[model samples]
Target: MAEGGYIDFHVHLPWREHDPREAARRLLAEMDSAGVERAVVIAVEPSLKLFKERVNAETIRKAAADALDYLVYMRIPRLRRILFSPEESLNEHERILVEHTRRSEDVLEAAEASGGRLLAVASYNPELGPIGTLERIKGKRYLGVKLYPTLHFCTPNEKRLRPLLDYMESEGLILIVHTGCDPGIWELPDLCSGARPSSLEPVARRHRDLVIVVAHLGSYSALKPGIYFDEALRLIERYDNVYADTSAVDSFLVELAVERVGYDKLLFGSDYPYVTGLTIADFVESILRMNIEWRAKMAILRWNAERLLKRLGRL
Candidate 1:
């Protein structure tokens, strides 16, 4: 790895056992090719099983329609998995929790196998409550917690989650919440509504010491209006603990993010595997092309993330 090497703040590790090790191998290979020194690898958080149980057919139908719109716009094949096989569920919350545990274990193993090139982040559904989830990860070697409000159908400021946020702050666990819009098998509007960046404001204010990262820079709606891109920017501007990542968004949004959020708070992230058609190399190259100084670009690509990991005691 180079001195000031690139660190991917976001990347997904597969839950499917069919060939997850091989998939991770491919991911590491891509990272090596792209000159990514290290990556914070996380497990997929969406539970199709939970969605199947909690959502009604009308909502699923709406989600299907939204999936169609997304498919047409993005022209990606991965989105079809949720639409064609909507019945396939991961089971109930218990099953989902079990799967998440297994996925976290797999990620830890992958991190170990990487010989320190990968850092594992634990993913939990806040719906099950934080105490039980914390018990599962007790004494585990992970740097952060991954939250998917859109997939879990909850908000960060939910009364029940205050303890969880407090615990994260106490434990020095970085909270990487999935913000902005999410599509595929889940109801689009509801998921988007739950994950809006503003929803995190209260929690960010309360847990001012916790490191909060709003993934995708809250521009999940692309260049369209009605999303929380501006809200995300405001949070970062208002709170020193709040930060944003450039994951699964276009270069235009990246330009906007750097100009507004500044380089110190921006981190490089690749929503790999889910962010189809782009390799880690492509993602890194996009940042290289952005109209920013080399030092700022390096900060976004590595220094900022490395600094955060050090603070979290992961580095």
Candidate 2:
């Protein structure tokens, strides 16, 4: 955990009434302590506002601010960067009761003003519009399409989302989905309860060419107390395009997941704001203490993501 190399693909940013730079600096210090080399900073499109109203306590974390935090504290042997998706990018087609439009240009301008250390994910909810809306995005800033089935009022299996998924598949874009056999809450479960990773079978069958990345490795679920592990793993088995991350995950589960999935199929992520170095390092230590080979263990920590990114030309 001291001095080594690791790339964190899934990390979050804190946007709760603090200087974005300061928040990122604190996070960077923590990442340094954990031996994380580079990080893929991800910001979601503020799609949440459509579904959930603000309680006086919690503020929305914009995709741009998350990217800003990463840049603010970016300096080290650190490949500090972020993946940001404005919440409103996907809602352009629909006529909401409220007109909440966080345009891609606006998100980009805010991010550029923050200096550097930012990249983005272009989000298109084909549910909102099909050919025109999605076609508007040339996708210069984004690595791929980020789909929030829950926030946009569509499940992954919905016929409406299929066109967008199909576009991504045909275009070879990386499609990141929120999965795990989930409940029915727009903020909670974007995909349907029946739309588990296994539920993605339809999409997988139709779009075998797409690189479907499942967020948090399908960690958040209803597997009883300890029975859900196999259910999560079932996703990886079900889809070849499926990939999982270590974001927002606890230590024991991370180690167990590495054991089950092996290092090749896994990636590192903090689900930041919600994720922390202490949370990830503790898991790394637990896994390293086992009799596993150092290479496999280290691959889970760092090498795996590197290979994937290289394949995507991010490296």
Candidate 3:
């Protein structure tokens, strides 16, 4: 790895069921072999009872603390708890909703237990109920908040959700949102056709200072080869605070994103364990070879995350 260069973000981890030590060993090995400098592990714990590790807007964190605990160490690859805040809109059991709260504590403890290798991304619907979780978790350490209107089943345009967005903006927290087509997956049928990128216009219009992260590369459509090229261009043009990540996005699409959005607004991420680190690294390195400056490439890989960490004061 180049001096001081690292893979800005990596969101995968192993569970008690999977083994964190082994996951860490494997991750470290992979990074060493690939020359990936530093990496970020966004701890996640999925809702297994939700029918087979099904991922949705509600399960935004994507993994459990037990699993996330696997990757924690003294700190070879920095650990971050992508603290997933579960939503109750789809959960009738209230028990299921409370589970997210319980899990948040477990995750925080686990992150601290590893001596601080975790980060949290609390996600919830503003219209659902009082955001006690946000108020409570504020003074503590966390990366920011992640939002998914397309999956948790909220219209980003809803006036009801605005207050929460406004609050987040004032809090100076980073927000991540899934823009574009969610695709039809059996587990999260509701997200198959959720809010589109344009729907975010209302929130973006209101909270210009909020650091918004656009995930899935805007998942656009109607292009000749079916790329999000236009959508990426549009979102960057519309929101100054808006940033895009490489989560679950393909290599070709990643290049398109870099090509269209430029390097500054682009951040490197793997949505992790959902998408492998090796797969992501392959694409990033490939595109970077084609006349892109090393500085810009490094910016996408590290500086972007550094900026967010500084904003969150996580240094």
What would the TM-score be for candidate 3 when compared with the true structure? 0.65
Kindly give the number of clashing pairs for every candidate.
Answer: 1, 13, 20
Clashing pairs for model 1 are: 49-90
Q: Please write out the lDDT profile of model 2 over residues 209-263, one tens digit for every residue.
A: 8777666555554322222346557666666667776555455676677677766
Off by over 4 Å in 1: 14-23, 60-102, 185-187, 222-226
Instruction: Please give the distance, in angstroms, between residue 35's alpha carbon in candidate 2 and its true position after superposition.
Output: 2.8
TM-score of 1: 0.83
Using TM-score as the yardstick, the better of models 1 and 2 is: 1
Best candidate, lDDT-wise?
1
Q: Report the C-alpha lDDT of model 3 over 1-315, residue by residue, as the tens digit.
A: 345555545354433323444455555555555455544544332233433234543453343243345324323211122223334323432333333232334434434534434455545533333265466456755555555553355556677656666777787866666666432221222333344556666667778888777766665321112234465558777788877776656556666656666778777775544542354456456546645567766777778767766776675
How high is the CA lDDT of each candidate model?
0.74, 0.52, 0.53
lDDT of 1 by residue, 81-105 (tens): 4455444432332344455443666
TM-score against native, each model: 0.83, 0.64, 0.65
The weakest ten consecutive residues by lDDT in model 1 span: 87-96
